[model samples]
Target: MRILLVEDNQALAEGLSTILRGSGYAVDAVADGASAEAVAAAEAYDLVILDLNLPEMDGLDVLRAMRARANKAAVMILTARGTPEERVKGLDLGADDYMIKPFDISEFEARIRVLLRRQAGLRSSIVNYGGVTFDLNSRTFSSQGVTLDLPAREVALLELLFLRAGKVVSKDAIMASLTGFDDDLSANAIEQYVSRLRRRLAPHGLTVKTARGIGYYLETTAPTA
Candidate 1:
């Protein structure tokens, strides 16, 4: 998943970004609300972790602008604002979840998982497709109770394709969600990863279909002989 983290506190932002990336999320962080708004507008993100007290523009205004521009990424207000009015206003402006600062790290990550899953229209943490099962919490793929050990990038790719499921995900979209701002992966590299992932899934009755000039999508069922 890709996340846009908007926080003015450099220390907190770096810490959260590291944690999120370690958990298999591609995160781009901005220290101001204006940059947050611009970055969020330009990129496709699965979630936005926003801080209210921002330089130049307020986070609520950022949220408002995002919704105005029809950015459907799940927004989470992660700030020191703990008052009822602040929380209500953020939610009224389309924030999916709210968290006050000095919070528990475990709970913060858990909330993010729930919001992302909700954004993907998944009702549960466990996803099953074409005889393969994925546990979102454990971030593991299994088939018939056998756990498949995959490389980190492959795991991220699988989760991305699994979340989008039947939709054709473009190569640009895949690169954006899988690679960070400073990463140096190319389209050919992405194709290699996809090919490797395809082989890994084939034994489990899963197929990764390419859409000609577009991109790729996970087939919903096993291919017929």
Candidate 2:
């Protein structure tokens, strides 16, 4: 999953980014509301962590603008603004969830999982596909009750494919989901990652098929026609 973090505090932003990335999410963070708005509008993300207090633009205005532009990424307001009126206004302006500052990391991560699951229209945190089961909370993959040991990048790639199960995911989209803004990955590298993932899933009868010049997709079943 990809996330855009908009927070003015450098320490907090870095800490949150580390935690998110450690959990297999590609995160891009901006310390100001203006940058956040620009970045949010330009890129695609599974979620946006927005702080109401921002420089250059108010967090609420950023949220308003994103909604105006039809950016459908789920937005979670994380700030010191704990008043009931503020929360209502943020929700009224299109914030998906509101979280107060001085929060527990566990609760914050749980809320994130909920928002992401809700956005994807999934009722459970465990996703099963083609004999492989993925635990969204633990970021682990298991097949027939046996855990699959895989590298972090491979795990992230597999999660992306599993989430989009029956659809063709473009290489560009894959690149975006696997990398942060400052990271650069060549097409060759993407192919290498996919190839590795393919080998790992082969035992489970899960195949990653290329769409020729486009990208790749996980084939749950072979075509009979």
Clashes of 1: 0
Q: What digit string (tens of lDDT, one per residue) describes model 2 on residues 1-225?
A: 899999999999999999998888899999898999899878999999999999999999999999999999999999999999999999999999999999999999999999988887899999998878999888899988999999988998888888899789999899998888987889999999999987778888688999999999997653222
| Collision count of model 2 | 0
For model 1, residues 1-225, the per-residue Cα lDDT tens digits are 889999999999999999998988888999998999899888989899999999999999999999999999999999999999999999999999999988999999999989988988889999998878999887899998999889888999988888778889998889999977767889999889889988888878887889989999998556343
- Model 2 clash pairs are none
lDDT at position 30, candidate 2: 94
Deviating ranges (above 4 Å) for candidate 1: 220-225
